[model samples]
Target: MTEPIKIDVWSDIACPWCFIGKRKFEGGVAAFQADADAPEVIVEYHSYELSPDTPVDFEGSEIDFLAEHKGMPAEQLRGMLEQVTGVAAAVGLEYNFDILKHTNTVKAHQLLHYAKAQGIQLQAAERLFSAYFTEGRHLGRAEDLADLGAELGLDRADVLRSLNEDEYLPAVRADQAQAQQFGINGVPFFVIDGKYGVSGAQDPDTFAQVLQQVRSERAEEIPA
Candidate 1:
């Protein structure tokens, strides 16, 4: 049996592009899987906090947060967010930035790590992105995270205890350190087979092409 291709995706729950990219990547996977000769693919999500210093409960709109922290004009930020919202919509994601609660994602990242241990990281990632960008759920506090975990059928007490005790904090930090080593300064970065690095929220075609290329290269490396 051929080994499966492992894709390590570095992204944050607060990142709008990450969710869009995820949809595109899934599309690519579907396209690739249509071929009977296609290899198996495994996707793993990693933690990458965009704003580590953000307060757990931030006040004001997304624009206000950017204006205050990034020092960009509110008008420019609004335009950018509008464009992002449109892109997200194109990928079948509804991003409600107006009601988005900008908060520190450290706790959320830790939750992802916890989910990874339980073999449900993919579901956890989707829930978090939806909660943050679409549902406008608060992701910082332990109580809120515990509730979200419960919605996923995870043990609410265990989730709350994990968050409160920071059980997976070390794993989150380790992912961050690895991202730093890779010189990844942005979210939605894709590391394909630990060799090819595809940045940004690329189109489905782009992702499919990359996967095909990787498969071809691997095929050539094997003794015929």
Candidate 2:
């Protein structure tokens, strides 16, 4: 049996590009798997807080947060966000920045770690991106996160307890520490087979090409 390829993706819940990248990567994986001989692929999501200092309940709009944190003019930020929203829409994501609740994502990251342990991290990540970007849901608080987890068939009480007790915090920090070791300064970074690193929201063709190249190399490495 061929060994499955492992992909580690580091992203933040608050990052707009991360969500876009997720969709593009999924598209690429689907294309690769369309081939009958394609190798199995396993994806694991890691924690990377884009703005660690952001308040759990920020008291401003998305523009205001970017303006203050990035030290950019609000008008310029608005224009950039508009462009991003357009790109997001092209990928079938309805990003509503107006109602987005900018918040510190440490707790949310912890919830992801918890979900990873439960073997539902992919669904959890998708739900989070949708909640934060499309639904304008609050992700900073434990109650909201637990509710999201419950919707994914995870035990609500256990999810709440995990968040309240900070049970998976160490795991989240470990992922962050690994990210630093990799010299990653951005979200949506993809580590393919732990050998190749693909950065940013690359197109589907790019991801499909990378997977094919990796598969070819792996096949060559086998003994004749």
TM-score of every model?
0.98, 0.98
lDDT tens digits, residue span 54-129, model 1: 9998988999999998899999999999999999999899999998999999999999999999999999999999
- lDDT (C-alpha, whole model) for all candidates: 0.95, 0.95
Find the 10 residues in a row with the least total lDDT in model 2: 111-120
lDDT of 2 by residue, 82-199 (tens): 9999999999999999999999999999999999888989999999999999999999999999999999999999999999999999999999999999999998999998899999
**What is candidate 1's local distance difference test score?**
0.95
Off by over 4 Å in 2: none
Supply the global lDDT for candidate 2: 0.95
> Against the correct fold, how does model 2 do in TM-score?
0.98
